[model samples]
Target: MHNTALQSWGDSFRAFVHPRVITMLFMGLSAGIPILLIFSTLSIWLREAGVERSTVTYFSWAALGYSFKFVWAPLIDRLPFPVLYGLLGRRRSWLIIAQTGIIGAILWMGFTDPAQNLTMMAFAAVALGFASATQDIVIDAYRIEAADADLQAMMSSAYIGGYRIGMIVAGAGALTIAGLFEAEGSYEPMAWTVAYGCMALAMGIGVITTLIIGEPTVTRTDSKYFHETSDYVRFLLMFALTVIAFIAANIYTANLTNPLKSGLIDAGMISELAGFIAGTLKLAISVAAAILTAWLTTKVGVTPTGMVQETYIAPVKDFIDRYGKAAIVVLTLIGVYRIADIVMGVMANVFYTDLGFSKEEIATVSKTFGLFMTIAGSFLGGLLSVRYGVVRILFLGALLSAITNILFAIMAHLGPNTMMFAGVIAADNLSGGLATAAFIAYLSGLTNISFTAMQYAIFSSIMTLFPKILAGFSGTVVDSVGYSWFFIGTAIIGIPVLFLVVLAGRMMQINADKQAEIETKT
Candidate 1:
């Protein structure tokens, strides 16, 4: 009887371990590692090493990787890499390039000393961020394209599970290294090197996974027509645009020179770094304009007519029919959640320190406690999605996310009692996890096999842009207004999302009715 029970359990576990799901897990890890390295973890390491707080805060700009992913998204969407394309096909070729860059950048990070070569470190971090962002675009596309509509929920659940696990390793593990490196008053470099090395190795899992995973079959219908065009024309247009944009960007670089160089000089708010900030902005604008031009080519063709006509042939115009309602809800919730979290994040450590909580206490409660809560939320959300349907669960998760942001505001006003802090962190993280899982599942369901990679990349990229732009000024806001108001504002920001959620739910209802009407007519 014991043997039979054990066998049954093993069988059940095996049934859930689909190869596509396993691939998503590794891809998620690859996607997640560089995120912390470039943003939070990098900030922590710099501050600990006696870098200026402002410089550490400013380095947050490197996260433009997540925001500007839409810029190169078209390339991954349409352009085949010359060397890798022949071997791995269009999708997997870019995946291999991105994964390799991620590993290389991490290794470079391990070798550099912030104290000696902070400029190089910033560049390296940007490289890692870009590679990571690129990897995310391809992996998201693959996960969507590789699976059927029904299987997408499970794939998303597995992907989030992997991403959360990666976060644990990066966040908790890096801090543990920092703590271990601390002796008396300072840190030893060994801990950072080891931590970075491990991250590089972890990224390698993506490189290996790319080799094993099958490329999605890309029919002409699958790839937008913009992809089939001459590479020389695309390259020439991009080059011409790059020249015009670089001139404006150079002015920004000139302004930021002092601030960028300040940690090495003195930390008196080097007014010079303003130029660099401006340059980043200019470059961002140029990249956006170029990417938009590339993306526009797809909609100009008669293929859209074919898709419209073909709609009459299938059961409800094929499962690939746009789920515009779900898309809006998912994107809105994503925008709100990230904006709330990030807008709060820049000031969070400063708030804790101000409240007289020691670094060790903050680390223990926030990182450790938040981790488990998030995990619980993710697991529960996955189970709920499979049981209750992704759309319903997504709506509930978004509502919960809004509720918890309010809870966080209350906690912020109440002061830093350990128990209350832990409570807020738990609630916030759980809601975040639930929303993340649900949102991923919802996005996955909307992707059609054709245009799978490009459309999914576009959606994922869309979701990141607003939050990232808003988060850039989080520090400026907190510095100007103070903490309590900041938290309250963050919480209130969720109100818009609640309305978006209701709108999305109604839209989904309309779509379902329309789909049903079409089905009956056929």
Candidate 2:
């Protein structure tokens, strides 16, 4: 039996070399090109243009597009394009459309001047974010659907390889390109714009990949009929939640640093702490609403297998039914897992720039060197997952993840030494790469294969939202407390993730035992 298992594994591993599987690399590239451009790369540009740290960090809000992509994942899975659908098929057609949108948006952003018209630049960033997120939904679904279970892991690795390459281009390559275009005396927006245009052109790799690849053969399983009474109730519940989320977002935005810090903010008769008022209220209301909605499903005699599937227009039900109440704890861990890294990510380039490192230094030492480290870390992460089990590796990665930032805090005190910077970058990327691999594995394990696209999108979206939200306030924190203290805060944020990961492991064991008992009885 062991020999049989070994042979099966060998065959599946060898199949990873198939040309169809390798194509995910370029698709991954197409998926990756815009991320750093709109994120850390763009943050670098904003800082150069004299944008305040607060506003620069708020621009991280554009990342909110990724956090909410589950909203559109279902449509991407099921919807076909008007003209392109017949020509390219369901997946390719959507890919082409989104790729085109990315090209256009990146061009628009390239032409816009950040210093003169920050709002328009922000608009450009948001548009780019939306297009990128749409493309990601299609790409993720395509990756999952195109491969069998054994091959899916290989495909995911290839996709990430391509993704890291794209990051290299948009992050390091963009900076280097812009550094070249910078005039002798002053920083140049035109130089950065020109760099963006190049990124838009590189998207052709994806466009070509889509046109060449065959679409996955897919069939729908669930009859997502909206007319059903239970469906209607679920729809109303999700709609109400959506509205509540929208209101909560606006309230949070109005007082972005601390939402309830305003004089008027309150929860019934309970007045809260002075700080984090708005953010706190937003969290409390959103959580309360979610709990109430979940309870309502029970009271209304809903099966809740896919309670909000039809409403959110995603396959959330498959996951909900599988995990039941455990989903909250699972999701909470996911949400906070990367806060240690992501909250600090927004300020990295800015921190480098402030520390008197030129863009050239950042591109070469930080991005380029860090890319190699990240790749190494990624490979190591996969190996560690195999040997130690994914959950155990995850806790170790989280520990390394938190500790790595303390290196940055030390760097903050030491300030701008190139050797020290390289060490920090190496540690940072290694831990980041390790944690990312483990986290993706964890999320993949939880997804139902049939609902892979929507469910995975939901997980990825939640994983990103928390960190981005916290990162948005990072500038405020830095301004109030300074970078060293801010890094310290970011490091401490991971403490909760570590604890939750431990709890999640325990919960997962209980669930596994329950499944085992039921199987034994049957």
Clashing pairs in 2: 259-278, 260-277, 260-278, 306-317
Candidate 1 lDDT, tens digit per residue, 60-171? 7777767656545655655668777889888889988888888898888878889888998888888888788888888888887786654566567677777777877777
TM-scores of the candidates are 0.75, 0.72
- Distance (Å) between predicted and true CA of 349, model 2? 6.1
Per-residue lDDT over 112-157 for candidate 2, one digit per residue giving the tens place of the 0 to 100 score: 8889999999998889898999999888777767754444444555
Output the lDDT of residue 269, model 1.
45
Clashes of 2: 4
- How well does model 2 score by local distance difference test? 0.76
lDDT for model 1, please.
0.68
Off by over 4 Å in 2: 1-21, 39-60, 83-89, 111-123, 148-154, 175-194, 217-222, 226-275, 279-309, 343-363, 383-389, 403-417, 466-506, 509-522
- Candidate closest to the true structure, highest TM-score: 1
lDDT of each: 0.68, 0.76
